[model samples]
Target chain A: MKFRSMLAALAVLVLGAAQAQEPIRIGSFLAVTGGAAFLGDPEQKTLELYVERLNAAGGVLGRKLQLIVYDSAGDAEKARTFAKRLIEQDKVDVIVGGSTTGETMAMVPLVEAAGVPFISLAGAVVIVEPVKKWVFKTPHSDRQACERIFVDMKARGATKVALISGAGGFDKSMRAQCLQVAKNHGIEIVADEAYGTGDTDMTAQLTKIKNTPGVQAVLNVGFGQSPAIVTKNHKQLGISQPLYQSHGVASKAFIKLAGDAAEGVRLPAAALLVAETLPDSDPQKKVVLGYKREYEARFKSEISTFGGHAWDGLMLAVEAIRKAGSTDKAKVRDALESIRGFVGIDGVFNMSATDHVGLDISGLRMLEIRKGDWTLVK
Target chain B: MSGRTASLATLAGIVLLLPLALQNNYYYEVAIQVGLNAIVCVGLNLLIGYAGQISLGHAGFFGLGAYGSAILTARYGWPPLAALASATAGVAVLAYLIGRPILRLRGHYLAMATLGMGIIISIVIATEDRLTGGPDGMPVPALAAFGAALSGERVWYWVVGATLLAAVWLALNLVDSPHGRALRALHGSEVGAEVTGIDSARHKVKVFVISAVYAALAGSLTAHYAGFVTPAKVTFFHSIELVTMVVFGGMASTFGAVVGAAVLTVLPQALTVFKEYEMVVFGAVMMLTMIFMPRGLVPTLALTLSGRRLPR
Candidate 1:
């Protein structure tokens, strides 16, 4: 009896060791439980979608992909620590997805040292700039968004514009780029103002922008209540000039929060949210509609650019793994760089090592809220 | 030896050996943060413990210092060390100006005033995108001193440790001096201390300004070390966290502040195993600690170990 028990114990130990070595784990650090839950909850769903789809098509290198996610509450320092733990302890094959640029950059050093591919969802050029081989991004960079907004603004005849943005990661970069883009395009930015995360009133800044001479339009950047602030306050102050919002405010939440004031607010958005507005014959239309149907059916919530970012990040990572035919970071990164004509929910992705930003201005469609409904303006 | 002296000696020895002992970059990172928290809490303890004043808006000073340094370095191309000095000086001036009127109020009024200061700073930091980089806060110029940039966890650990040690030593010296005693006397009974010839209002304002400088210096160090600063660093939440460390460690004891900061910092990391439940457990522990041992972890633990319960 004692001999039999010893043999069984040895067998169990062997099984445990083999099971541990079976699969490559991918770590996802998101704001899953914090103020950014509106963003991270969908991020978790997209990650799951990737995992399921990858497994359905025969797992990466015949090894089932394991995903580990942590909630950093959109805190950069916390994200950094979580990234380290994921690399060192969880032993993830790659680190994917971050809620904010601050959180994503915080992971750069650790993931680089750990020799894992880090694909960020945050729209910061710094995330992939001076491009480390191990670091790549799937989101449109802040610079691209800035260029797109200005290009659209100039096209729309918004020459003299006032700028107001929330003092958040994406908005900060976007605002800087907007100013540079304005200088290049000869778009006179009359007034520039800012606000914080939890601010409810932006009357002072909005008032300043309203009072600025020759301000034909307002370029509102940042996320959360800031966009809502511009929307409501602009109407209240009777500043009927054109309002151009950053992609950060391209959300149903913004509309809901801003009430009737959200009407007639033009913003740049990925084609995913308003895919139905595109003709059925459009190739990108089918994939986006499919995601919209599936996402609404499952999550019962409206999709936003934020979720579209997650969808793109997750799908791209899965595609790279499949193309690489292995969980190896080097191979996966090469495959990611080589991605061509990949129709994602966000945009048609064509990534290369030199250009980690898969989608550019072409992929983004101009969206406007007209009478509390999202309409494709261009 | 007095418990304070012994605790200070132990802290000094630990800090001295910390860089050598912690070879891991992760630990170095945590230690660097602990040092930063210790600096903030030590400054906060001056107001809460010695002067018996509360400022819920200390984070405003911290934010101003961080944003001041970040903008100076990033926009003006000022050297980081020079920026740090200028930022600290700027905050000191701002604090004195803001505190002159606000500190006159007592208790909740004072708390509310400080809270307003924090809110105003946050608003300014958030809105002034042209100047402060707005709510996303600006990236700090890397901590460069004498032409070399301070990067990596190991270097930051030493710099922060030395700064924290100096702060503690300064605070310790102040607490031991006649000025500290006068502050303490004022804390115990303002009228009595005034009767005993301590300039109650002057001492309060002085301690308030001193504490603000400490917070500002700590904020500058934090921004330089992290190579970034956001308004979140000086938000009300951060102020509350600093106050928590001071009160949780034993409000009157400077060593208690350090211990509180260290324990709270490490606790969250250790409790990461609980995952989402960690927050719940953290809240529970905090509540229970405050309810049962209001003097804080260090004093309560000391008292227990000495086979004496805290006097009701």
Candidate 2:
């Protein structure tokens, strides 16, 4: 009986070792509980859903994918600590995370030092501007959004614009980028106004913008409820100039919060926002629609662009791992940079040595909130 | 050993031994954060606990230090050490000037004044995109001393740990000094302290300046360690969290401040395992702790276990 028990234990150990050898580990830290939960929750859900689906389809590179996620709670310090834990303790091959700009930037130095591939889902340009060897991003940058919006405005003959921005970090960066790009595009900003994040009303700022003569368009740059409030206040104050919001307000929640006031408001957003509306010729439509259907079905909620970012990040990492044919960090980093013509939920990713976020202004489609629904502008 | 010496020694021992207990870089990073926060709280305790003054704007001084050091080092090509020293001195001078008039207010009036000051500072930093980099914040150059740039969590853990010990020692010495006596007298009652010939206004202002300097030093250290500075560090919420650490640790006791910082900083990191329920559990834990120990965790636990009061 003792001999039989020892043989059984040895057999169990062998099976366990074999099972662990072919599992690929992907780690992430996201703001799952704090202010950015709206972004992180969807991201976390999408990563889980895709990991399950990918495994069911026989996994990548003949290995099952394993996910390890931590809640950063929208704190930069927490994000840094979790990034270290994921790299040092969990020994994850790649990190896809940081729901906001500040958190992502905080982790940049650490991940670079650790020599791991980091694919950030945040929308800040700085995360990839310098192009750290190990760092890449999936979201459309604020700079791209600014350029797209300005290009559209220039085409419409809206030369003079007024800028109203929120006090948050994302809005501040977007506002600066918009100001910088406006002059290049031959657009003049007439008035610049700012609002606190918790301000209940923005009519005072809107009133100033309305009073500014030669202001052909009003551009509102912010995230969350502030942009929505600006929309409502703009409509209520009867500012007849065209209202353009930043891509920060791409979600359905903005329309829900702004009520009928969101009608005719335009912004640049990921192609995922109007996946179903895209024509058959558009490459992103099929990939985005597939993700939207699967995510909505599994989670019982509408798909968000934030979730598509997660899908793109994970798929990019998986593609790199498959191409590398090994979990080696250096090889995967090279593979990620060299990847080209890969269609993702966000857009076609074309990474290069100098450009980590290869998607350009073309990745963002001009979307208008028509009757509280996202409608693509031709 | 005297109680003060014994406590200081115990703190020193823990600082030396903590790395052995930490299994990875993440714990060291968290420990470094705790040390930085404890430095601020220890000084804050002097103002609130000893001087009986409230400052809802302490983070403003902290921000000033961060931005001052960052601007000097990153923009003007000044050495980090010189910038840190100058920034700290600048914060001290600013605090002395602001504290004179604002420190005269009592109770909620003082609280409101401080809150206003913090909001004003935050707004100025956020709006001034030319110098301060506005709300997106600017990168801080790394600290280099002894011809070497500071890097790694282990190195920062030691630097911050030693700084925290020195801060605690200074605060403890002050508590045992004549100024500390006068400050405590005012904390007991301003009328009573005035009757005893204590210049209550002068003492309050001095403590406020000292505490501001402490927060400034911590802020400078943090900016160097993290290599980034944002207006978020100087926001009103950060000010409240600093004050809360002082109160939650046991106001009068220096060790309590350190304990409070350590527990609160580590608690959230440790609770991240709970995932979606993490915040709910954290709130419940805080509520339960406050309910059971009105004097805070360290003091209340000491009283219950050894039947002795902590040194004020």
Evaluated with TM-score, which candidate comes out highest?
2
Best by DockQ: 2
**In order, what DockQ does each candidate have?**
0.18, 0.27
Expressed as tens digits, the lDDT of each residue in B29-52 for candidate 1 is 777888888888898999899899
Residue-level lDDT tens digits of model 1 in A1-378: 134335536855885687654666888889887677877888888787767777777677677777778888887767877787677555677788888776876567667767888888878777777777788776677777777777877888888889898766677788777887687877888888887666888888888888788888888888777788778888888887888888777777788889998888888787886888897766689888888887778778776667677777777777788889888888888888899999876678887767777676777778889888789875
- CA lDDT of each candidate? 0.80, 0.88
iRMSD value for model 2: 9.4
Deviation in Å, model 2, residue B161 alpha carbon: 2.1
Q: How many residue-pair clashes does candidate 1 contain?
A: 8
**Roughly what TM-score does model 1 have, to 2 decimal places?**
0.85
Best by lDDT: 2
> Candidate 2 lDDT, tens digit per residue, A1-378?
134235536855885687865478899999887678999999999999999999899998888888989987787766877898898767899999889888888878888889999999998888888878888999988888888998999888899999999988888888877888788889898999999889999999999999999999999999999998999999999999999999888888899999999999999988888888899999888898898888888889988899989999999999999999898999999999999999997789999999998787788999988887999999
DockQ of structure 1: 0.18
- Among incorrect, acceptable, medium and high, the docking class of model 2 is acceptable
